[model samples]
Target: MQLPGTTLLVIDDDAAIRERVANSLEESGFNVLQAGLAADGLALLGRQRPDLVLCDLQIADMSGFELLRQITELDPDMPVIVSSAAGSMGDVVEALRLGASDYLIKPADAPVIEHAVRRSLDRASLRLENQRIRERLERVNRELELHLKELKDDQAAGRQVQLNMLPASPWNSGEYRLEHRIIPSLYLSGDFVDYFRVSDTQLGFYLADVSGHGASSAFVTVLLKFMTTRLMYEQRKQDVAGPVAFKPSDVLGHINRSLIACKLGKHVTMLGGVIDEAAQTLTYSIGGHLPLPVLFAEGEARYLQGKGRPVGLFDDASYEDHTIDLPPRFSLTLCSDGVLDCLEGTTLREKEQRLPTRVAEAGGEMRRFMERLGLDPSRPMPDDISVLVLSRNPA
Candidate 1:
C-alpha cells in the first residue's frame, strides 16, 4: 500500500522512459518530481528532500555515478534506485557500491518498479530507526556512569568517618600494655572495641562483634558504642550508696536490654573486662563470644572457659563475670570469629585447638601473631577481623 505524500524523484534524460516511470509511480500513489539534467535533479533534491530517488545509471548530462554520489553527499540516508540495461550488470553493481539502493532493468514493468521502490524504502526506515535507538542507549549509559561516580565518592566520605570512630591503640604503662586493631569487610565495620581507665588501679575494656557485615551491622556497632559510653557515664553519676558500678556483667546486661528495646533485629556476641593492677586480677564477662579469650603465662596458653547468652536475643538474658589471677608474665588475647578462616585445619576442632598454641608462640606480640597467620593489613579480608591484646613484659 502507498503511504500518503510519499515523494519519489525520477531523473532520466530519455523523455519516454522518464514519462513512463513518472506515470507508473504517480498512479501507485506517489508525489512524483522529474529532472532531466544532473543540475536540475540536484536543484529539485535540495528543495524537495524527497523520500526516494530514481535515475538512469547511463545519462548524457553527467556520469550516473557522480549524480548518485552527489545525492548521497546531500542526504546519506535517502534511498536511490538506479535504472540499468540488461547487458550492464557491471554498471549495476558499480552503482550499487556507490550507494544506489536497488537496480531496475531498462524495460521495467510497473509491478517490478513499485516492488523495488517499496522494499528499499522499508529497509531505509528500519536502519534509521535502529540508529535512533542506539543514540538513545549511548545517552543513557553516560548518565548512569555519572551517577555511579557520585555514589563512590559518598562511600569514600563515609569510610573516613568510620575510621575516625576507632579508639587510639597501644595504651601503655610500665606493668601492662594494651593494643587492638580492626579490618572491615567493607567501608564500615560491625566489630567495635573500647578501653579506658575506670578507677585509679582498674582498667575497663570490651570488644563487641555484632552479627553480619556491612552498613546494617555497622549501625548496630555504633549503637553499642553509644550504649557502653552512656552506661559508664551513668555509673559515674550515680550516688556512692546506690549501686556497684564498672562491673563487666552489669555492663553487658545494660547493653542487652538497650538493644532489645530498639528493635533493630540485630544481635551481638561480646566480651567485657576490668583489669586491676593493684589486685593483680582480670574480671571479665562473656555474652556468647567465641574463639574465646586466651590467657598466656606460666609456660602455657589456653582459652578462658566461660559462656552466656548472646546480647539482643531476649528480654531476660544474663551474663556471668569470671575472674583470673594475673600470672607474673602473662598476655590476654581476644579475637572475633573472623580469625577462624586464617587457621589451616581440616575441621573446626583442629582449628580451635591450634589457637591457644599460636597465641603462646606469638608471645604477646601482635606483629608476630599476624606474620605467623599471613594476615596482611593492606589486603582486603573476607569478613570483619578484630583483635585486642593486653600483656606484661617487653620481650
Candidate 2:
C-alpha cells in the first residue's frame, strides 16, 4: 500500500516518461516531484529530501549512477530505483552495487513501480527501528556500569571500617602473647576477634562468628565490638570489687539479649576467655562454637571440651565457664568453623578428629598453622575464617 504524504522524486530526460511516473505515483496516494534533468533532480533532492527516488539510467546533465553515488554520500540510507530502456544484466548488477534500491526495465507497469517503492520504504523503516533499539541498549549498559561502580566503592569503604575496629595483632601483656588473623570470603567479614587488658591481673579475649557473610553479617560484627567494649567498661565501673565481675559467660549473655532486642534476625557462635596472670589460670566459656579450642602443651595438642546454644537465637540461651590451670609453656588456639573447609576430612567427626593434629603440626603458631592447613589469605574462600592464638612460652 502507498503511504500517505509519501514524496517520490522522478528524474528522466524524457518529459513524457517523467510525467507518467509522477502521475501514477500521485494517483496512488503519493505526493510526487518531477525533474526532466539530473541537475534539477539533485536540486529537488537537496531541498525536498523525498522518501524515495526514481531515476533513468541515462540522463542529459549527468550519469544516473553518479547521481546515485552523490545521494548516497548525502544520505546513505536514501532509497533509489534506477530504470533503463535497454539495461543489460551487468547494468542491473552495477546499479545495485551503487546502492540502488531496485532496477527497472523501461516497459515496467505502474503496479511494478509501486511494489518496488513500497518494499524499499519498508526495509528502510525496519533499519531505523533496529538502530533505535541498539541505541537504547547502549544507554542502558552505560547506566548499569555506573551503578556497579558505586556499589563497589561503598563495599570498599565498609571493609576499611571493619579493619579499623580490629585490635592490634601479636599483642603482649605480661608473659602472654596474643595473635589473630581473619580471612573474609568477600570484601567484608562476619568473623571477629579481640584481646584487651581487663585489669592489672587479667587479660580477656574472644572470637565470634556471625551467621551469614558480607555486608549484613559485617554490620553485626560492629555491634558485637560495641557491646563488648561497653560491657567491659560498665562491669569495671560497677564491680569495684575485682575484674572477676568481667566473666566470659556474662559477656556472652549480655550480647545475646542485646541482639534479640535489636531484632536483627542474626546469630553468633563464639568462644571467650579471661586469663589471670597472677594465679596462672584460664577461665573460658563457649557459645555453640565448633571444633572447640585446641590447647597445645609439652609438644602435644588436644581440643578442649565445651558446648552451649548459639547467641541471639534463643532467649533462654546460657553459657558455662570452665577453668583450667595454665601450663607454663602452652598455646591455646580458637578458630571459627570456616576453617573446617581447609581441614582434610570426609565428615564432621573426621574433621574434628584431625584439627588437634593439625594444630600440633603447626606447633600452635598462627602463621605456621595457616601454612600447614594450606590456607592462603590472599585467595578467595567459600566462607570467613578466623584464628586467635594465645601463647605463653615455647618449647
Q: All candidates' TM-scores?
A: 0.79, 0.84
Query: 176-212, model 2: which lDDT tens digit per residue?
Result: 8999999999889999999999988899999999999
Off by over 4 Å in 2: 1-56, 59-61, 79-122
Instruction: List, residue by residue over 79-157, the lDDT tens digit for candidate 1.
Output: 9999877547788778889999998888889999999999999999999999999999989889889987886786677
| Global lDDT of model 1 | 0.86
Best by lDDT: 2
Model 1 regions lying over 4 Å from their true place: 1-63, 77-83, 86-133, 239-244, 260-265
Q: How high is the CA lDDT of each candidate model?
A: 0.86, 0.91
lDDT of 1 at 302: 89
Candidate 2 Cα lDDT to native: 0.91
Please give the TM-score that candidate 2 achieves against the real structure.
Answer: 0.84
- Per-residue lDDT of 38 in model 2: 84
